[model samples]
Target chain A: MKKRYLAGAAIAAAAALALAGCAGTAGGGSSSSTKTLTLAEAQKATSADDFGGMDGLVAAANAEGHLNVITLPPSWANYGQIIQGFEKKYPKIKINSANPDGSSADEVAAAKAQKGQSTAPDVFDIGTAVMNQNLDLFAPYKVQSWNDIPADYKDADGLWYYDYTGLMSVGYDTKKFPNGVKKIDDLLGSDFKNSVAIKGDPTQANEAASAVYMAALQSGGSADDIQPGIDFFQKLKQSGNFLSTLPTQATVASGETPVVIQWSFNNVAWGPAAGSAGNPNWKTVVLPGAGLGSYYNQTINADAPNPAAARLWEEYIYTPAVQNLYLAAGAYPAQLAAMEKAKTVDAATLSKVGAAPKDFVQLTADQATKAASLLSAKWAAAVG
Target chain B: MTALASNHGAGATPRRRGARPPRRPGTGWIGLIPFSVYAILFLGIPAVLAIASGFFTSAGAFTISNFSAFGDPVILKDLVGSLGLSAASAILGAVIGALVCYAMLGMNPDGWLRTIVDSASSVLAQFGGVMLAFAFIATVGNQGLIIVIAKQLFGDSALSSPIYTVPGLTLVYLYFEIPLMVLTFMPALEALKPAWGEAVATLGGSRWTYWRQVGFPILAPAFFGCMILLFANAFSSFATAAALISQGGIWPLDIQRALTSETVVGHENEAGVIALGMIVVMVVLMSAYGVLQRRAARWGS
Candidate 1:
């Protein structure tokens, strides 16, 4: 039901762009006349074909000499290695990654605030709901591998596309709970008293919000409804089982939060980090039920200071090599199915992380918007 | 007297009608230009923009609707929480700081005790935000030193404290607030002349009478003024509270929510609205502080 709304909205947006005739080109206000013309052309180009070829795009991006990316932490989904690779590949273009710990909302805000400046973000790696609301801020540009990405995961007009995804999972201290819970209901027992924590504030953090949605699905609610999740948390709080502190590697190691609900990738990353922090008994497991998956989308800023560099970045990350980096980091890349079919994916990493969940549930853009509004209205009153 | 008379005579010499007086030596205020520009650029412009944003909608259209956030029950509750917390910390800090200042009166001016305490007060007053919060957390948090010690000494049913609660937050705020109070209030204490006490004694007044008639009366305005400054200090603090607590239970956290809420769309202006509230309170208290400082300065020189 929610998928239909997303498809309809994407179609409508594409049609509106078509009716406008020309591609939207928000100007880069930081350079000289010649550079401005180059940036303008880069902003208007929808694909490498428009610039003649990938070689032409690379030259144009080298001329720009800089790329601004935001909300991309080095440790997230093996972005540290991916960034180093991009820098090694394009030595001329300096990648300025700003506010690496900022949120998806903060990325949009920075793009809007720094639109015309040299410090403006050239690309955004943001969550779906924030991407949906700020669609106008993006310039439609397709990568060479646009065909490989699933149609449902990318905007019809190439304004935004999914980059990487992860499933929701339960991470726990093995010493405290040697026999991990087989079900969500096990957390409600006395043994888990005042020990259960979420990743962060549900109304702000994507991981925490996904935890709620995962609980809602397990409690018999659909993607369009998130009230049951709030109710579940409220029940957890009333039973003195819910710990208000956000669960982090430090908290997990210190036994402050014995159990946490967060993204599977984060939990997987924490296993080694927590071990070094003295708690070698950390364990993560995908719950035995319907899996909830969420993905962060990538988009080019319409007013990118280095438009050519932005386009090059989008092209670079979507390649098979970069996508494999995400896979190795316990995340399922956007082009996983295509890579698997073509045998381009790294098989060893695939076997280690297990096959991607084919039937994992996701919130459509419209469903995400609805769920966000619902959480904003009821989360505090319910859980507080 | 001769210099004044000669200056008057020179000024009285028939000058051109509407001509300006001669510039006085050492009265050149041009040196203040850099500071003025710095204040206007960094402090003035951002403040104006933040306040002006509250009057506009997300679409950039002028509207008064954003101020409606003030009427929100949650906002009001948080405002009350902020007020109570600030008042508690500031009042306690001021009283304790004043006593410490009073105790310093008996010490020799050049002695090690006064020198060490004054220097320590200056440094400790600036120690706040995440570092200060971490200090308290390591000392008294869930797995902190004191708690671990208590558990070891008295077993499981022993001294578990509310180090994560509102009370705990007040205690953390006072860690810096008291030191700041000492730094600000000590100058007024040092301004007291010994001759005033000697005059009171010569007139057959006791030490209590001298303090009641002379010391308390003069320090009253400065005392209350420092307390107000301390209130404003705690009221506008965000980082210390943010580091200690995840949820919004006070005014600054409400601003943080408005600025960073991922679920709620187009409410960033409410941060400005909350900020405007803080500005109004600060402006009122600072005006009173200005007047009180003027009164306090009379005895200093």
Candidate 2:
């Protein structure tokens, strides 16, 4: 009996050791395929380097046959339709979208964590503030339509470029607020008590951060200063109108969050969805005084697993067809001006977006970075 | 094992007649090889790296600024909040859970009701994080069923604070904490033999006196051990709170902020420092638990 027990213990221990050894060996394998075609060099490629045209680049991407995208919510900016169009265009290359509900910070963290792994994100759709913070993690690659993109929109080295932009707006349930919130100050009324909410933590989420910046703009702060925005939230909290919880469609329909400060595109898209989900009175309005617009950027991960496919994705997103999809979803596509000039934009889609406030102020990279830092340092104290 | 023990027993009888030789050192250590290897790979390496990073700069130079950053008032507030939340939840869970266990003791242990409650407690204790937070929100949130019903009945706002606040969070935590308490404290309750009660009854001692003298004394260490476990569990928990509260002004949230907050540049080391602080707290609590558990083991045996 003693010998049998000893043998059983030994076998279990040996099996565990064997499993550990197997796991170790498994991870160290699978990174040794030598490619005659390297995607890292594609960043510096001209027409000649890619066999003289866009056709050659397409062939290369098709050969690779895979793309890993992170943080592309299907509802946000009509990524669902854009992704479908891309897949339909590139039948050979498969797209693996990860964490559709994850925030911008989660995307950057995944890029950092999975740096050299085969599972690393090939493409990223994140806030410009996040893109600037993690610039070293991006590989410089300009699409074929790079010339049409505004100079202010794209990085000089082509590490990152604007995809679509949205204005910050206030959304409210029509039934709850019979007298609608037409301005930022209207949100401070006792009727809106404990009803105002943003998407998520401003320090981590771009939409919420932009909302704060818009509030700052409305409350005497310029593009460079965000203190007024924090103070605005503080006063809102003091007035018992601020709710720290993230406002989701469910929360909106449930009447828990009747007022939300979010991006115009999100508000526009979510309003109808919330209406369909039993809250028919959902309405959105862009605040005239707080006309601040922010754009999300597109970039290729520095160590993307499917580099060719990533570059192809970047090329595809900036095209007229995809840009129109963005516009139809209520976001102002980055290539809107170029498409308008070329008359390649779908007029019907342009009409659907209607008109947004034109007096919007754009933040420089430095100003955004400063504002993010100040908000991160002060937001908790202000709201708490 | 019996054959080896017999052989050893035979050898020891003769050895006992004279002087026993010192045992070989490696012989005793061989049994621990598997556990030691597992710990070194998983716990030991990560813990060492986390501690080392807390003392280093992003460029890998030695620095104490990471530790000093804890002096920030926000960070201090988070620490206090985390401690207060954990303590409140743990104490509440322990008292309520202990009462539940005592109630179970009066029921027939083999009955279907006891069996169902026992199984439910086991399952519920582990049911927390995102799903649990959402569950509470659906039940007691601003537009929750209970709130809606109460509003109709009273013709006014029934609950003053929303479910996302600290008080609301404590209420949500109690949902899991009470069940966890029942599961942990039930075994200690079961260890209380009927003979102890019978002996007190024969001695003409009242029920209250019997419990005061025998029941409470025997269960005290186990109760304390469970409370510490609950405290540590609540202190380290992040997902439930993260899902509920968007702006984290608590320790676990601060730790998450240290890791994921983009505004604070080079916060990875600061995260390591915060993580190290959490580890220190957990270690201290666990050590106390370990001592209490050992003390309780005597009564259990």
Candidate 3:
């Protein structure tokens, strides 16, 4: 009888704790009593219109008090400043950024694994390839500046939208190639023997895939057909100029891989990082006539535990101030066209990054998917 | 031969009957609860889930088509490459580790040298993944320290560097494999009783004759079992090779490519199929190891 009493008491205590958890997530702070929209309503909000206006949305989000973000490395494209800028603009909310070095796929997996929990990521910044495959996982929330975004750069329903992109460029040790590589085919020369490398396997990584697509453009293959890119790599390998090593700052500094093909922003960023590491004379060049650009997409997790804060974060990042941060890091923002037209872009930062390539190609969703499949089918055979 | 046969018979029967009491059936199983729970949670459930996913399509419909990944020439090549690498590393590791064990046979167990070797083996066997890959890169990579020295002595063409290739990977695998071999094969080496040598000498046998007739028979199973264990260790290893090789040159890397490819969708279940294949390979290897272990144990006691 005494054991049964203890068991019953334990069950009651567990039930109380469970209820407390639900209450904590749903409504905790004193300000939540004045919240116009419930957490459920905020989760379904497609725009601030659902909360009457942006001010109402702000109040609801402030009540929530916490936002969960994943896979946004602070160093990438000046996210560190953007995050700090958001915190300064919204002091009431605390942003929790987890797994800052995780990949796009890892972001999706974490969201799925932590679905309804308060710790679940409320937002995602993922590559377009992964974003296309996981449309159903995102909430269709349009920011207040949604109309300024290009029609082709976002989903019709605002499920996901382009954030920033960098032109695919070649970064090399200036000591090795004094004249600099003026064209993609320069990598095939004898001086570059066993020296050229991409960021990762083209079949898997976004940056490496973009590098191949850039090669495809130069080799007379369209975005829908990337076979020429494979042939180009095979030819380079045959000439003993293609290295399979994944190039990092350390490897570049050590001269293990003298030339790396990746994003212009990344390579430009590497000029400073690798200089500090050892090698001081690093240079990046966006080869003319073959500029390929790809953008990462941002979206709200459909099952966000802090839904109001997720929407508020969307509003925060899309602002002109935050978009200019991408320029400072040598990347072109999705709103570059709009900001240029409105004369709101940061001109000094834009000049430093140089002009966006006049004749660059950004593959549509369908084109990228087709290109990806082709790469998956043929990459290992071509370069294995 | 007659003396050895008599000794074996005398050693086997009476001890089997008298040494071990019949385990109390139900209560004795209580000790296995924690292990059983751990296995079920970590191993058994994940294995079942992974293998089951291989038989299903992405939309949850049942299908066997996912197994077709094995038929891909690329996958077949990866499998062959992985198996050959594992075999090479395992055989070399076993031989070198066995030699180390042989060298240590006459050492005092509590001596500083033996203690350091034992502790180092225990630590180095667990040292792998990114740290090991970085160490090798810093030591023998294209522009590494040894390569720089060699380049100065002999022209650049004298030595073809192998730091990022399969040969280099095999050499790296041996770093830990040799140590593991010492830790595992030492017991069987120590099990060689001094009395057995004395008995052989008394029977007018030479040292080589005693080894050929007795020592080889007793130690062969244990040696092969440890070699198989090392093979499994190399087979399942991923991070070290992944850190070194960018492309999918092995089974685990292939699985990594299938699952995490940013552009490839609807092929995630192929990772499960590949995992199932690995499990099948492990099951066969472990079964052989079990049989070898039982045989070795019989002789050991």
lDDT of each: 0.78, 0.76, 0.80
Q: Candidate 1 has what TM-score?
A: 0.85
lDDT of 3 by residue, A229-334 (tens): 8899989878878777778767877888889998887777777643476468788888888679988888999999889889999998889998898877788989
**True-structure lDDT of candidate 3:** 0.80
Clashes of 2: 2
lDDT per residue (tens digit) for residues B191-226 in model 3: 889999999999999999899999989899888988
Candidates arranged by DockQ, highest first = 3, 2, 1
* Candidate 3 wrong stretches, greater than 4 Å: A1-35, A273-279, B1-18, B155-161
lDDT by residue (A1-384, candidate 1, tens digit) is 122334534643554344243223223233221233365777888998776678777777776677778878665777778899999999977777676767788888878876776667899888877776778999999999999999988989999999999888888888878879788878888777667888667777777889999999888887988888888888887887877666666777787667888877777667763347535777878887888998889899999877888999999999999999999878899999999999999999999889999798898877888898788767766765
Tell me which of candidates 1 and 3 scores higher on TM-score. 3
Model 2: per-residue Cα lDDT over B50-77, one tens digit each: 7788899866799989997688777887
> Best candidate per TM-score, number?
3
TM-score of chain B of each: 0.88, 0.85, 0.90
lDDT of 1 by residue, B8-57 (tens): 22221122345678878774688989867877786788789989988888
lDDT of 3 at A73: 63
DockQ of 3: 0.40
Query: What's each prediction's clash count?
Result: 0, 2, 0
Residue A283 displacement (Å), model 1: 1.8
**True-contact fraction for model 1?**
0.38
DockQ of each: 0.20, 0.30, 0.40
Model 2 stretches with alpha carbons more than 4 Å out? A1-36, A43-51, A273-279, B1-49, B157-161
